[model samples]
Target: MLKRVLLLLLSLMLITTLLVGCGGGTTEPETPEETPEATQPEAEETAAIKMAMVTDVGGVNDQSFNQSAWEGHQKARNELGVEVNYVESNQDADYLPNLEQLYDAGYDLIWGIGFMMGDVILEAAEQNPDQKYAIIDNAYGDTPSNLVGVLFKAEEASFLVGYIAGKMTETGKVGFVGGMDFPVIHGFHYGFMAGVKHANPDVEVLVQYAGDFNDAAIGKAIAIQMYQSGADIVFHAAGGTGDGVIEAAREQGKYAIGVDRDQNDLAPDNVITSAMKRVDNAIFNIAEELKAGNFPGGGTVVYGLEDGGVGIAPTSDKHVPADILEETRAIEQQIIRGEIFVPDNEADYNANY
Candidate 1:
């Protein structure tokens, strides 16, 4: 009887344990497995570097370097995650204030777009020694520690386009309208003249300047006068003012060569080609170099045909003859091979022209 009681008690204990093992007839929701993304840590992102350019009175839309520089800046922003901005100067006095504004805002890089800012850049670069600065078309002989200079071998391109103008002109006449009489402008004048002479030794070339880069009216007036005075083709290095030269060429039924950027679209009929200075490339390259930690600071970067800095635009594809285009390509190769040395200064112009 005691053994039976013991077996019955053990059975009762086993039944209780089985019931508990079955969770006491209760149910619980399922737990999902851990996902890989949920276990991943947050990534650390690098902040973008801020950069900006200050335009001369020509403003950013001048479709020249101001425009080209802005395009390059935009491209850097797109490709390399750079933060870019621009300040447009409406007058001469605005250059200083515009430059200071960007510097004070703590821009990583500030660029001045024209030679007109040479002195002001010098002054600002000196006062703000910690601030980085750069300028196009002008090289400071004694540059500040934080400043970089961007220059071009514009004469080489001018020579190529000048050669085109010499061959294309119907009246044995061509013209040039410049933004200023600065050394840089002289580079264009001398090279264009030299190229024209190379193409046709007796082609009569006319030249003038607007005394300002912003005055399209002055440029147009100068261009109309030249075109009417028997010039069948004109080339202009006058920033926005050159836009007027395009108009004058159209109205006068003449051919024109553009500068800084391609002006062919302004008047396809009138523009034979454009002398390109690749300002966009310069600005983009600067941004790239700065971000790559290789900033070419405290010195000038001179870009030329060999450096892919200067050339004639393809707008002339429709205008340039097959043989002449082939010849120009050969000339470009010669320039690159050091067989053709183009002049860049007044003395050299005198010697070569």
Candidate 2:
């Protein structure tokens, strides 16, 4: 009877254990199965640097200085993996606002595309001491620590084209159209005059200033008048206004020389050659230097024939004779070797001539 009682008590304990295992008590959620930590994604790459430019009144499509500079910025973006952009200035009044727009966006570097913006760029640099700035065609007497001046020997390039004009003119009379009476224009005019005289002392060069760089009509009118007056070739340093000069040449069946860029495409048959001021190279090199952590600021970088900064366009071979091109190259070497000194101003031009 005691053994039976013991068996019955053991069976009752087993039944209670079975009931507890089946779900008679609260669940503890299985400790959430020891969940693993979440994985993270990789970080993205950023641009090496950011650069922006404020174009002059000529705008980026001027097919001249502004256009060339924009090309440089594009090349920097493509080749160096840098961020690049530009804002056009429709008029002189737009320069400040355009620069301010780029400044507010916090660009690593800012560029003023013309000498006309010298005063304003300098003022902006002084106001924002930490920001970097650069300008083309202008240099300050005392540069700020954050500013760089990129100057080209326009006279050198102008002289080469002027020599072409003098040598190629069938009427023995070539013409010059200037944007303004400013020093930069003076460089173009005086250098051209010197080159013309150097090439052919007897060839007459008529001069006119549109007093505007954006007026194609004014340039066309001036060029037409000059063409009618017996000039067979015309060279212009009048920015976008030079486009009209080339147009007039096409219409009148005369020759035109472009400035700041290779403008042969503008009037393939009419445009004989161009004066190339390597604004694109200047801009690209500066961006490259900045990317390499060697920003050259607080100084002026002068680009000349020796450094391949300024010269006649490569398309000269298409129109100019091989002998002429050879002679031009010889003269180029003379200038580079310091055997020939091209005058850039009125007084020097007059004194030397």
Candidate 3:
């Protein structure tokens, strides 16, 4: 009886041990199912570029240099995805402040339009060495390494227009009206006179300066005086003031030549043609270069006939003769090919005269 009892106890202990081992092997706390590490997305990057322009005293919509420069900045904004802005300078004193405001606002490129802003641009560029800048029409001495100076051989186009004036004149007299007394403005006068002489050596040119760019009344009065004095064609380089010259030509039934931009459409019947300086093209090219990371610096860039920087406007379908158009094109080709030289400076003018 004692042996049977011991055997029963041994069997019970073996059964319990087997149960514990099976549970441990099959169902141990599932090593807390390791979860995938959480991931984060990378940030996107954006382009950083800005441009600004300071207009001349005549303002941004002056239908001349200021307007052209503004158009260039607008182009940069549209094509390059850049931020752009502009400030119109009402007086000479406003130039530096306007440029400084743009620079302080973190603009990468700043442009000053017109020769009248030459000194202002120089001063601003010197003070703001970290900023890139550009000036049109004149370079004030040696520009800083961050500044670009743009000038055009406007005399080439003026000479062509003057030739047309000389050929079309019924009277032996022609005239020139300048916006200011600056050497830059005088270049137009000098070239026009030379062209007239080239076409008709006996023709006389009466020259006058309006001293202001926006005074259309003064321009009209001056133009009328010239017309009454037996001048058949009067060429004007007087900015907004030149509008008066066209008006005078229309009133007097005489011919007028426009400048800077094509004014033939202003009075298609009276404006024979315009001496185009390609100011818009210059601004556009400069802005494009800046966008391409090739900003011109520390030097003056002079664009001429070969670069399409200067040319005569298309002959008026309303008034310009086909023969005159053909002859003008022939002369233009000669000038571009170095077969003809148009004078700009006073010394050159005197020598040619």
Candidate 4:
């Protein structure tokens, strides 16, 4: 009887050990199930929407509009979880090919950085009707359903800087150096001239066009001539060429108003203000719209002082007088409230003035 009791106890102990081993096997399988949950978010991130841009002739780092636009896409990547990239265009010939490269890569949205690319973007949009595209500084009478056009009230911003130039000039004159003589650039000229007139009609505005946006040497030469001729301040609407304008200001102890981006960093003491276009804001907004399924394709979207799309650099306070900033803000509100119409063209300028 004692032997039978000992054998029964040993059998019971063996059954308990087997049960614990079986439970451990079940938990091991559960770890793999939890692994997929840990990696699921990574999979979603890997499938994120891709966005890209093709730079204009000035390339991506022109320290101008192209750089601003690229910054916009980069901001989208950081805040919106979209992948972004850019391709440099050495000349007009590279526009279509560079765009095609991004397009072929299956980018969900592609951008052409300047008005010079209006035709190229249009061509790409027409060729790939299913693809979506956006262009800065250009608007078309007719465009395909997949394209978006972006325009800024450049004149409004130009007017603000022009007012600053007019008020700050001690030499009784200011200057304007432009990249091209097209209507887009004309907006800058007309509005600036208007603002100078508004502030001091007797203050002369010396105007010149570099005819090329890439040559900093020519821009510097033009600005130097204007300064030598008794102009104390200069404003530039040129692209990379505008860098020369700021350089001349720094070297000549004069002030320069920059364009497209906040160029105060180029020459902190020399660049008093800039006609801020908010291209980065525009591009980021478009990306947000796309992510929200509300993209404004096949149409034009205009940005201006009213919508905070265009304005002067925040750094103006360091170089601009408190009274001038106060007055400029007042004029900004006037434009926003429709009490003032900043002209953007030759006829409108003449009519308004």
lDDT values for all models: 0.90, 0.92, 0.85, 0.93
Candidate 4, run of 10 with poorest lDDT: 30-39
Candidate 4 TM-score over all chains jointly: 0.87
Estimated TM-score for each candidate: 0.88, 0.87, 0.86, 0.87
| Model 1 spans with C-alpha error above 4 angstroms | 1-42
Segments of candidate 3 deviating more than 4 angstroms: 1-48, 315-317
lDDT of 4 by residue, 1-353 (tens): 99999999999999989998778445545334344444443434346778999998898899999999999999999999999999999989999999989988999999999999999899999999999999999999987789999999999999999999989999998999999989889999999999998989999999999999999999999999999999999999999999898999999999899999999999999999999999999999999999988979989999999898999999999999999999999999998999988898889988978
Candidate 2 lDDT, 1-353, residue by residue in tens: 99999999999999999999998888676665766778767687666798999999899999999999999999999999879999999888999988889999989999999999999999999999999999999998999989999999999988888888888888999999999889988888988988888899999999999999999999999999999999999999999899899999999999999999999999999999998999999999999999888889989999999898899998889999898889899999988888878999988998898
Clashing pairs in 3: none
What TM value does model 2 have?
0.87
lDDT of 2: 0.92
Point out the worst 10-residue segment of candidate 2 by lDDT: 27-36
Model 2: colliding residue pairs: none
- Model 2, 111: alpha-carbon shift in Å? 0.6
Give per-residue CA lDDT, model 1, range 44-126, as digits (tens): 78778999989988899997778888888999999989999999898989999999899889899999998889999989889
Compare candidates 1 and 3 on TM-score and give the better one: 1
Per-residue C-alpha lDDT of model 3 across residues 61-119, encoded as one tens digit per residue: 77666776777677767777768889988888898899889888888888888888888
